[model samples]
Target chain A: MSEKLATAPRGKVSLFGVLRSESIRFFSLNSTRILILLAIVLYAAIAAIGTWGIGSLRASMGGMEQMPGMEDLAAPGFASELMGSGLVFSQLILGVLGVLLFSGEFTTGSAVSTFLASPQRLRVLAAKTILITVVTAGVQIVSSLLAFAISKPIADNYQMDLDFGSDAFQRVLWYGALAVAMAALIGLALGMMLRNSAGGITSLAALFFVLPIILSILTSITDWAQHIAKFTPDQLGMALATPSSVVTDLESWQQLLGVAGWIVLPLALGAVLLAKRDIK
Target chain B: MIQAQQLTKKYGGKTVVDNASFTVQQGMVTGFLGPNGAGKSTTMRMIVGLAAPTSGEVLVNGRDFKKSRHPLTEVGTLLEAKSVHKSLTPLAHLRAMAATAGLPVSRVHEVLEVTGLSSVQRKKVGGFSLGMGQRLGIATALLGDPQVLILDEPVNGLDPEGVAWVRNLARQQAAEGKTVFISSHLMSEMAQTADHLIVIGRGRIMADAPISEFIDNGLDQTIVRSADIEVLMNALNGDGVQLRRIDEHGVEVTGPDSVTIGRRALEYGVVLSELRPLQRTLEDAYMELTRDAVEYHSSNVAETGGGK
Candidate 1:
């Protein structure tokens, strides 16, 4: 016990240092890998089944343009847009991953060790924000690509067009990742603010699952509700990737800015609370 | 050196630690002794900036610890043994901490081996026993090879052998000139491990002195035994002196210093066989100072008295 430590001396704490710590700690847990795998597989499986069902239905309809409920299935870009039909589930799964990324430290009492190691509270938050952003964005992109790869052949078998290079396909692939990342960032913010896993996940569900339906009902009653709904985390993510879903004409850049606002506001608020509150 | 200048912490409307101030110097183990809920853990938390003090400040080596570039190297703190995620293995936990301080993985294994946790380093911490958790916590405190070590209740769940190891580790670190501050409610543990003792009761500093000075600071009592005990007792008695005859051959004397009583014994020439200064154990001194500080006393004291 009295022997000198043989390891090399360490330098000061930096952003990269904290990031390296968060990455190692994040990956070492089995739950992180399991969540990422489930998100990808669940997204691709849903996309494939939905594409097959729609393709088979369109094939059986001897067609004379007589179908009323299948109007969305007839759109030129419907295949690409349908590839992200499971984005909501991905958002739920990856968003919980983001929540665990921050809330785990508080829940397990490890905030004491983490804050002691770094001492700067806001720096820890900044590192976690970057970590979840990169991870969720990367995971969502892979899940989208996989979903498209699996769903395209089924649509092609039914004489339906599923082009990868279309403008709508590119939007769903790229902006869909951005939207998933937005949901994840919101979850991260909720986790930091609440500092409890159950509370953070429940509130995240309220935001993505409950609030969207509430707003959709209100939009039917008032035009002002539609304006506010467009900027919500769910709507911003959706409209940015699938522009055909919106009734209002929103420029691509404006949708991007809306996504940016949803991501920034919650994180900024969470950071302020993190810096102010004491670590128990 | 570590200093807390009027460090005050209040939670809601309750004051947990009230204007506590002390300086812990380097090159010795300074024991922080207090009763349960006496603000020892709160004070330790403030030192490392884990719990923000409502007012005043705590400094490490003359600067705000939170501003230090090398925080882990400056201070290795173990505020609680359970400061870890339940699902994480000890190896993963220490690796993360080492990475934050830019320390290599080799250092993590070194501390684990030293703390006797290498065999179980990869095991999940959730299933660790109380003593094993403490060893892992100590392993983390040793990870940075820090200059200042602040541990709160480090030996709470250790066996006798593990207890001895902690004592040796504390002394060994202090021998290297690092500032070692350890807190515990057990006086016997502190008595054996600490060189200087700073006692607190009810969030107030009750005593601060060297270990020797603390024991000697209590009422001066001497034991004198002789064939002619009555003659020695008469010579030892004086204003403010209380004498109790313990046996036919011995008497207990208090109020005067041992030197004065020795001189009087020599002057009387009562053929004294033994004139010994009664050295107070740290337990005795601590119990005397904190008699009013035992929180959650039994409602019926007589029923529980001497039951243990």
Candidate 2:
């Protein structure tokens, strides 16, 4: 039993304070550390193996100089780019990390603590959004850089040019990181909306994995399916990362709008549900 | 002080709490007594703005809680047990909550110690026993040293010692002039801890008065046996008085104190063999109030009633 005291000063909730709290909770978990480690290790390992396999193939094809388009296949720094071949897996892993960031609150009944501490529920949502975005972006960038540094020499051994400053290379680095951020944001939104780990993760997998394959098959049958497929987050993110390979039908502004829709719609819906529903 | 006016909450066509209204005063532990599903938790949630009232409003310190900027400092609540993350230790959870109000981390440790959670402060809440979880919940409620304290089922999982501890804590808080509001199903606990009682049944207030007044307002009966039972029964009848014959030499008198019955019997020249006033426990009072309101009333009510 404690005595009643004078009312405490209720200052406006600063985003920085909320972010700090999110960071503390995020780093406190063993799962977060494990996910980040797995993302980096898996990315580097996939890159190394792809580089070795591609290098051996090029060596074997060296004597067939007359093969049309074979030289393009041996393009310089291909092996270096191969090092980041596991970006898709990285996205999935880190995206789930984002999903767990919010879903775990509900699953573990910690949303009560979170919302009670900052009753402006949307502020907590915004804070978590910012945290997942920054952390996912940071991890993606660092994982890509590590993979590139390790695979550069392997590409050079095969006499491939590995320029770090090329526009294509930078696109793969920066936009690839952005793609990871997008995936994480989408995952976070789904997590908040679903508020269950399996439901959120399954929905994310369907969006990124199953739906894209289904759309690819659908495109073979109809023109309208191709138009819809071009706007999917999977296509948009892939086009944004590998500019030379995945040519998107969307203009720059259209792609930006698609990304915005992907991020904003689910998050807005999740926030509304969170504000309206009971914490239990 | 906490004032709830016409507070109502409806979920999908069912009204959980129906226009409940009551004012809880300071310097006393007011017990919120209700049968299961009587909307005690809903009322507590509405007070803190956790669950919105469909109609009406609840005010803390003369203002709506939602509009109050300094809510945590104004009112501390333990709404439910284990409303914490499983992965988070009590230390991290409390520190995070304390940081919201810019309160010192030192206060977190202080509350942990106060709630007897110092030993388990570093343990993850997932590993905590129910009693430990309750302690952590209480520690969180006490973090802000609030003017108004609202606890729903504070002693639900406590052992006997923990129960006594909660009783002391409630009394000590009230002695310091804070408005302490606690809800529980345990009538004996409420009887020992609450100075004022507000009994609710079926989302409505059944009785609101001092603990003693609730006990005294209902009924008082005494059983008397004498060689001249017929004489005793005649002597005890008047305004606000009634009598019922028990057997050959026994009678039960209602609406008269034991002293008055004994004095009357002596004045009427009846030698009483046995005279005793049946004490009414708080459990009896609660049962009388919630007899119709209990969701599952036992068939033995008649048998229990006859014995009492």
Candidate 3:
């Protein structure tokens, strides 16, 4: 046994190796697979339903020019906007996935194994970040494509334009993926910070859902609140993916900066805490 | 070899591991013996860089383990049973761990076979019994075929056969010049497997020595009972010999073996009904050393007999 151990080939830990490790474990669990499937199905279903709703609304109104206070909904890009109508739900689901990716390690005591193997805590965090990013972005892009595939026929029935080559549709497809990836990364940061699955998920929900409602209420009374509301994760996502659906005065660069903030700040704080605190 | 220099860890205001300094040598199984909450797990965590020490530092193979590039190959640690995701199978967990070190997938299969976890490798860890979980933990630690092995409470829930297997594994690893450091509260287990023993209690190092020296440090104690115990005591009285009266006819003899006492008794023609040697077990020595250091002493158990 000793001789066998001595002769066995040993390997070193590299960033690429840890990333592979994260992916291996990430793909092995039933939760990950279920979450991804649920996100895709729910996202596509919402988008398809949205396309039918808009098409039926426009058909009943006689024509796009007949709609009076809903000009944004009658725009040529509205059909594409329907493809990302479920972006919020997709964000929540994939964000929860991100939270679990990190929180599960601590909640299940697997951080002991992970950290012991790699030692450098930041490397593990970086690997998880990359894994979740690729995964959420990939899942979001697939969901958007599936939504488009199902919604195109519904839009055609109502003579609504759902052209795949339109700039607005491309934005919804690509930026929608970016929006979901952003939420997932935020969830990842919360997971690393809280180290509890429930707490991380709750925090992610509050950031995406509750906080936006609260900010909207505060925006009515306060000028600062209005400015902050434009930078809220929900608004930032909508502004980037379907800008016509959510009116905002900020330029594209400014909206992109806001998205970067949502992605970077929480992760930076989480990485700091993860590196400084004990794993137990 | 692992060296800890004044390693200390404090949780909030309470010091869990207080300034402990000890070295675990290679080529021998070193046992870390302590009661529950004695900071054995915390110390092991600190050694592998899981838990950061409040003060001081620990080095594995002469460098900080936190900075180790080839961590798995340098030191393999099993801090707790089931340090794994419940949703994962043993095969998945091992493969993931092995991937971190770029180790071959075959090594994962090898460790599973060695730990006797091949049959349940595909089973989810959530349903595993405590013993099975422990086996999985051991399998993970051996995944790297590491040069240094640190296992805490390795036999907490193992069967007799499993326990024996771990004992043999530790010995075999040490024989191959690998550093084997195991922590346990079971003194009997340590007595059989460890060549060197480091005893800790209440977060303090109580004793560090060889297994032989640990049991042999105390003087020889023998309990002699006879109607003519007075004659035996008188005959055995000499340099390094101390005799204490247990009863009117019984005397506890110290500093001489039973054979010597028998010889002296024969010379004195003493009629002795009992000449029993009181052997100092590892348990007794450990209890003696950590008498005042037990964190949560069992009031009923400690108060009843001799107050262990």
Candidate 4:
């Protein structure tokens, strides 16, 4: 019985091995595949319906509205931007996928197996980070492309040009993926920090869904509330992905810096906590 | 070989494993014996780097095990719980663990078969019985074919057959010159499985020695009831012998086997009404060793049947 395995030379735990292990476990779960499918289908369906509804409205009215606070709704980029109408919801679902990636390890007591195999706590964190980043970025990119493909014909029915080469359109396509990716990384960080699935996902929603509303309410009474609102994850995602959605004075570098801050800070903090705490 | 040098662990001013130092020799089964909350689990966790030591270190094969270059090959540890995501099947879980150390899929199958988990390898662990989960945990520990195996409370929820299977497996592994260190609160289980014993209590090492020596240190006691108790007591008195008189007619004699006591009584021509030797079980020795080290000792029952 021992001779069969005794002769096989063993290897030290490598980064590729860790990554492959994470991928295999990640893909085999029913929840992960279901969430990914939900994100893609939800994003595409919302974009298609948004394009059809908006085109029908424009056709019946024979023109677009010209009123106060209607400028964003009537912008030239709005046709291409229709593809990203459901991005916030998609980011929420994909962020949930991200949260589950790390949180599942603790909630199910599998972190013991994972850490005992590698022993270096930081390496496990590194592997999860890479896995979450790669898979979420890949998922977001596909979701965006699927939404765009489904929305294009509807945009053409209204004689509105949703050109792929337009700067605004290209920004919507690429930066929308970036927005979803950032949300996912933040969710991953929260999962590691909180180490509980329901708490992590709820906190994620509170940040993206609830905090944005709270900040908007705060903006009505205080001048500085708007300043803080501009930096919230939702604002950063929307402001970057759909550049014409909200008026802002910050340059592109500052926007990128804000996005980088949202991604790096929580993950860095989570890594430190993970290294110090017991696996249980 | 596994060595812990003054290993200490403190959780918020409460020490869990207090200055424990012991060596688990290769090619033998070393049983970690202790009562509940005696730091047996904590010490095992520290050995595998799952729980950090507040001071000192643990070395596996004469090297620091925390930053081991080849952890899977050096030591395979099943610290506590199922140690697996419940949603995953045993096959997928083992396959993933094997991938971490670059072991072959055939090796995964081998461990599954070794642990008798191949029949239910594809079933989700969430619905697994506790015994099946334990089998999977054992299979995981054997995935890398590690030199050192650490299993904590392996027989907690197993049938008699499963229990005997684990006993045989530990013996088989040790016979093959591998280190098999298992922790259990069951003294009878440890007595049957371990060649060496490291008894711990209240986060401290109560005793560390060979199993035979541990049991022998307690000695056998014989209850001798005789009408001529004074003459028997005088004959049994010696440098190592201890005698305790219970009533006017009974005396407990220790430090010598019962056969010697009976022969001395025969030679002295003392009439014996009763002569019964109390064989010292490992359970008795363990209780004697950790009598003061028990962290939680219940008082006498205040009522029967919950005062119903």
**Predicted model with the maximum DockQ:** 3
Each model's TM-score for chain A is 0.93, 0.91, 0.96, 0.94
Mind giving the per-residue lDDT tens digits that candidate 1 earns over B128-170? 9988988888888888888899999999889988888888889
> Candidate 3: which stretches are off by over 4 Å?
A1-6, B225-228, B247-249, B301-308
Return the interface RMSD of model 2. 3.3
Candidate topping TM-score: 3
The positional error of residue B12 in candidate 4, measured at the CA in angstroms, is 1.3
DockQ of each: 0.65, 0.42, 0.69, 0.60
Q: What share of the true interface contacts does each candidate keep?
A: 0.75, 0.26, 0.79, 0.71
Interface RMSD to the true structure, each candidate: 1.8, 3.3, 2.2, 2.3
> Which clashing pairs does model 3 show?
none
Candidate 4's displacement at residue B59, Å, is 1.5
Better by DockQ, candidate 3 or 2: 3
Sorted on DockQ, highest at the top, how do the candidates line up? 3, 1, 4, 2
lDDT of 3 at B114: 81
Candidate 1 residues lying further than 4 Å off, grouped into runs, are A1-8, A64-69, A220-223, A246-248, B222-228, B245-250, B255-279, B299-308
Tens digit of per-residue lDDT, candidate 2, span B136-241? 9888888878788899999988888888888888888888889999998778889999999999888888888999987787567899999889877777778988
Per-residue lDDT of B98 in model 4: 84
Backbone clash tally for model 2? Answer: 0
| Candidate 3 per-residue lDDT over residues A131-193, each given as its tens digit | 999999999999989999999999899888899999999999999999999999999999999
CA lDDT of every candidate: 0.87, 0.82, 0.91, 0.87
